[model samples]
Target: MDRVDRIRERKREHLELALTEASQSRRASGWDDVALVPSALPERSLGDIDLSAELVGHRLRAPLLIVGMTGGHPDARMINKVLGAVAEAHGIAVGVGSQRAALEVPELAPTFASVRDHARTVPVLANIGALQLIAQGERPALGAEKVARLVDMVRADAIAVHLNVVQELLQPEGDRVTGPLLPALAALVRVAPVPVIVKETGAGIDRESARRLVDAGAAALDVGGVGGTSFARIETERAGVGEGPFADWGIPAAASVLECRGLGVPVIATGGIADGATAAKPLALGASLVGIGRAALLAANDGVEAAILTVGRLIDELRTAVLLSGGARPSDLMARPPVLTGATEAWARQRGLLA
Candidate 1:
């Protein structure tokens, strides 16, 4: 098969493998390690608790983002449509998978565009790989012009430049050399119409890198840390190989949120965020938003109604969590500290993040 065909095949494989149990990280995502201190006497009712949140100037009915999952294939079109419809109905943010495939093959553009086509009212995030921003061997760098086209293609409210270094390395036909990524990213930030959000695919970003990205004009950060979908594992599975040593590699989601927060940019805590309670943990740890991946994908697979049902459950649970923790809104969790233990606490202590 040619490069385009290979990409299409890989996209299909990713959708399939990600749903399997083996593709999930065996290691904890640190949500389990962080506990919210319950309010024995709650002052507010559940209806009074607000889940609405704002990120990069976009107001969301819930502090939840349906993290970018798929696109670039015929099958993905329906998936994006379903996810977009769900996000539209809820007034939340939604993202599309990397637009590289659609960029290379214009015929596939509608696949990713489906998100914006359906979710007209909410924020839509356009995606591109971190490595694509710079020259990689024979391939030319996707400079400002093409990058701007990505935003236009989806009418994206913001652009998400995904950092997937490990996923690239694990894939059979991956780009190896990531040349001077920071400067190229800074250049993109200069010309891009909307806010630039530097996101991780699965591996999390460290404090140093997070600070640098923020300095480079990143409007936000999606700490797509380990513990959710292990793209490394998914690639390995696609390669028909065993679960390698790097299967559970990278910082946990909870730790990554702590690392990225307070850097003067909003952090979207992703990875291993399965439920509203799990989603609440990151917010209490200072994350401005929580991203749901695998769980959303599973629900979308069942159809739009099923996905809406899942989202409703999550929103309800999130409201309950905020109320039980003595909060009236999602942002309130940020001030109402959570008790950190296990590796999450150790990570905070060692990183000097714990006060």
Candidate 2:
């Protein structure tokens, strides 16, 4: 098979392996012991709790959006359709994976087009790997704008410029990602003609990087932090690349949020977030929204209703946690302090971020 065929095959394998083996041991994204303390006799009304939130120029019924995964392939459209339908129904946002394949074959538009048509009336986000901003030269630059405009094409709300060097290094036919990424990113933000969000796949973002992205004109930051999908681990196993004794890699979700605190850009916490408390921790530590992927994928495989049912359950858990923390709404969680400890603390201290 050629490079293009290999990418498509890898997507299939990723779904199967991620669904099965990725669940083997609950790889700790280092949430072993950090938590937000519950408020005792707090002056807050749970009855008045609000789940409504706004981000990336769109309003959401909930604060979560299933982050980008795969969409340039035929196999992925069905999944996107199911995910999109549920996202719309629930009033959350949906982000399609890299659209490079569709760029390769305009015939593939239907695959991603299904996302806009299938979901409930919710915000959808177009996704493209950041490297694409320059790889295909002027066409890609123009394509980026066309992609940004595709929100209208698919009725999307925004777009995510995803950075995934780790995944590329591991993929068999991944392109040679070169050049200074920030300038290209800044240019995209300046001219994309849509709200652009800069996101990391799973490695986490520090305060400095967050600040830089904000300066680069990112509307928000989705710190798809470590402790969730270890793309390094995933790719190493799949494409058989990257050999550096990664007994482990990635900064945990907790540390990522802490480092990004007060950076102006809202941090979307993802990576190993599983439960109500885990969801609450990042918001408490300074994340704008919490992203759940693999867990959602597992739930989604059962069908759209099953998927939304699972997502609803998670939302309920997050709401309950928010209320008990004395937070009147999702935004209030951002004010409560999270007590970071253990490895996550060490990470904060190393960066002089722990306070």
Q: Return the top candidate by TM-score.
A: 1
What value of lDDT does candidate 2 attain over all alpha carbons? Answer: 0.74
Model 1, CA-based lDDT: 0.90
lDDT of 1 by residue, 275-314 (tens): 8888899899888899988988998999999888889899
Candidate with best lDDT: 1
Model 1 / residue 96 / CA error / Å = 0.2
Q: Model 2 over residues 1-355: C-alpha lDDT tens digits?
A: 8756765777777776667654222345656657778888667665677887777767888788888776656777778888887787778888887767666666667777888888647777887788777754334453545665455556667778888876676666565655578888888877776788888888777777788889989988888777777666676776555444552455667777787768776778888776766787777776778787787677767888888888888888888888888878877875766777788888788889866
**Alpha carbon lDDT at 177, candidate 1:** 89
**TM-score of candidate 2 against the unseen true structure:** 0.90
Model 2 misplaced regions, further than 4 Å:
2-4, 23-27, 42-46, 136-153, 240-244
Poorest 10 consecutive residues by lDDT, candidate 2: 21-30
Q: Whole-model Cα lDDT per candidate?
A: 0.90, 0.74
**Candidate 1's error at 151, in angstroms?**
0.7
